[model samples]
Target chain A: MLKENKKELESDVIQLVPQLTLDCVIFGFHDSSLKVLLLKWKGTEFYSLAGGTVRQSESLDKAAERVLMERTGLDKIFLRQFHTFGNVERYDREKIKKMLAHLIDPDLWYERAISVGYYALVDYMKVFPNPDALSDACEWWDLNEVPALLFDHEEILEKALHALRLELSFQPIGLNLLPEKFTMPDMMRMYEAILNKKIDPRNFQKKILKSGIVIKLNEVKRGVAHKSPFLYKFDPEKYEEVLREGGLFFI
Target chain B: MLKENKKELESDVIQLVPQLTLDCVIFGFHDSSLKVLLLKWKGTEFYSLAGGTVRQSESLDKAAERVLMERTGLDKIFLRQFHTFGNVERYDREKIKKMLAHLIDPDLWYERAISVGYYALVDYMKVFPNPDALSDACEWWDLNEVPALLFDHEEILEKALHALRLELSFQPIGLNLLPEKFTMPDMMRMYEAILNKKIDPRNFQKKILKSGIVIKLNEVKRGVAHKSPFLYKFDPEKYEEVLREGGLFFI
Candidate 1:
């Protein structure tokens, strides 16, 4: 069955658009740190974001969505195309040939291919990482511990993070990375993780309340040894309204 | 010479990457209105942004730079890749076939092509718009007066403009769309044009002055019937430092 699948993969390559691909940087938050989804290549030290090719009949966005679903077992999340990497130097023909020798024809069309970079924000607790055919393991890695990636993926990852950070500066996008019910401290920690720095606790709370995207709920969080903190869920209508009226950020 | 060049173009198409292209929305500001550069197809009322195909040896950024230089006769400006458009519905086979029937073979490889969108901020006075081989004229059109564009270009243009506006909401990008020396009123008008609304004059002055991206000059305007406004220029070092520090916007 493996042999037959490999043979079918060679024939299926013809249906993909030549010289165009998509790579997704899936970001999730957990344990007070921003994490990124990565896949470990089978029997190799290399890791990379889940990527796929665009089919002749599908849109680029759909291809990215399909790739995200195949790897994380999650869909309908916040995904955005941040940038496209197409430097001639990014195509290391000999290295790629060696890396995929067991999987692909190797003579396959990988010369100067362009990859559109997309960044996705998913709930940490909901994701179930699944490896692709060429990878042995797929899981979340803290941003600080991310190893050197394959191809131009490291640069792509940096750019994706930078774009996400820039958006966070003016927009309340941290809500996407947190659970529906979270504390103000949870929100501030999410922002600090993405920004890679510390923000004033007093300032964050004051400004966030003034922004009015979050509301104070009547219930407190359960299962806490210390004094339980108040639980808060995003006011969806207020959040959407603030987004439309030129977003206000606390950080 | 024209016939020979046409013959060369037919074979040269093979050098271009199949199913990938680029379109640039070159924006300029003049006379209190925001303008976009467009090309009118030869002997037809159809209009489109200056665009080109990527070559096998070049990066996407390099391809966009080449296309921008070809049309605007200007280089070293602020150019950015904003988004990539790849909808299956965007490809109108019959329309493109009829439009380029005189230029290329009927069986060209344009089925479901993906176009990377770029937006350029250029000085209005520096541009020398030149028509491409298939275009009769290239000129600037006011954003309000832009005609129905060819292909999915209208949607692409709108997206580029929206991206620029979103950036403006968080960053002081208006400097790129203005001249080297300008007055406070001139800067305010530039902002109003791009935002497509009026900003309170006193509030704009107070916020922009506090932002410190611009330096007030001692000299006043030379030609004016009423009181002449003082001229000012951007402080490059301060502007760049603010950008590096995640930008401070007045709008």
Candidate 2:
């Protein structure tokens, strides 16, 4: 029954007068770095942001989640709808025409397609990157080291980054990026990675500590350095309460 | 050439997939009351939110501007994209199918669709409401007396109102809502309407006056019961700066 309904919906979509697609800018923090999940085309050097079309029966949010899950074996991550890019030039008409001339038939090329862009933050170690049949491989590229991506994906990524920065100013973000248990230095490094700027270590620690969102565990980093930093974990219930109360601090 | 391109795009969409549409919730302030723009259906008791389909060659933002202009005959208003709702059940599929079966043909009933919602704040008096072909009349309804709207519009309006409340809390919002020259009471009333609660008159004045975002006019309101309140207007540039600096106070 589900399959039949899916087929019916697809046929309905084909009969409609406009097309909708979903694009994702998946960001991850690792090794004191901010990286974006990108896919390289199967037979060409062309790379692009991970994306896919929405099934006729699927909600736009479901499409984004499915795209992320397909491209990278991760689920239940922090995903958000950032912006919908609808400029006619967004598809690069000329380039699309050229690509379609060789790839898809010209008859299928003129379809009016609009895409919604969503951004997701995932734990780097938790995701197993899987390249789809259309792509050569999926890999995490340091945001600063991003190669030229196909279409307007670069612009979409930039917009996603701007949204992430804005969110960071008021939200507690590193929890999704760091391991369940980590040292203060580890958390600080993740912040530095996401903010993409050098922050005073002492000031960063003071602000975060004063926020009272992180709880220090009776543990410390093993080995290395003259003094082992204390480990900490986020208190979800308190953090959410702070978020709701509009008392979350951002600098 | 543009017309031909449009036709070709439309045909292509008919052969591809359905595209998401956009609906705008434009709220305005006037007569010491909050108002939202609405369009009444021509032959039925149904009322629809201001809406338009996303053109193949247009962005969502552009589509919103077009819809706003066409519905209200107003341009260059303060507009912002708030959120997009894509619940699978957003449309009453059963109702649509039944309507099409009775009114048109079943073949024409099958179409996949989703809608993105945007909210804008405008000056109510500046707009000339012009109902479209499908609509009987266009008018501003007081927020307190909104009629039952079609589809999931009431929910959409609620979401937009929530976002507006948050904006009022953190941002200086009266520049678009109030006239070029207005009194302090005008600003306070607008705030009270958005906050939906009575604020201490003296405390509100003290806080706003100290913010330095409003400039006192050498004028005052005329024909009042008691002492005429002093007139004041907001400084757009300075208010924007304060917004950026996150200096707006909210409790």
DockQ, per model, reads 0.78, 0.41
Residues forming the 10-long window of minimal summed lDDT in candidate 2 chain B: B99-108
* lDDT tens digits by residue: candidate 2, A151-195: 789889988987777667566777678899888788878877877
Among all candidates shown, the one with the greatest lDDT? 1
lDDT by residue (tens digit), candidate 1, A1-251: 13336566567754778888899999999999999999998778889988888888888889999999998888888888999887877857787777766655666545668899999999999999999987899989999999989888889999999999877766667556788888888898998999899999989988888878898899898887888989888888888787766567544
- Which one is best on DockQ? 1
Could you tell me which 10 consecutive residues in candidate 1 chain B have the lowest summed lDDT?
B1-10
TM-score for candidate 2, residues paired by index: 0.82
- Predicted candidate 1 versus true structure: per-residue lDDT over B143-248, tens digit per residue: 9999989888999999998888877766666666788889899999988998898999999888778878899999999898879999989988877877766566
lDDT of 2 by residue, B1-251 (tens): 12224465546653323446688998989888899999987556677788776665566788899899998777777777777777668868777545334333444433555778888888888888888656778989999999988778999899888778766765678777888888777788888888788888888888887777899988888998889988888877788787775556653
Error of 2 at A57 (Å): 1.8
Backbone clash pairs for candidate 2 read A18-B19, A86-B59
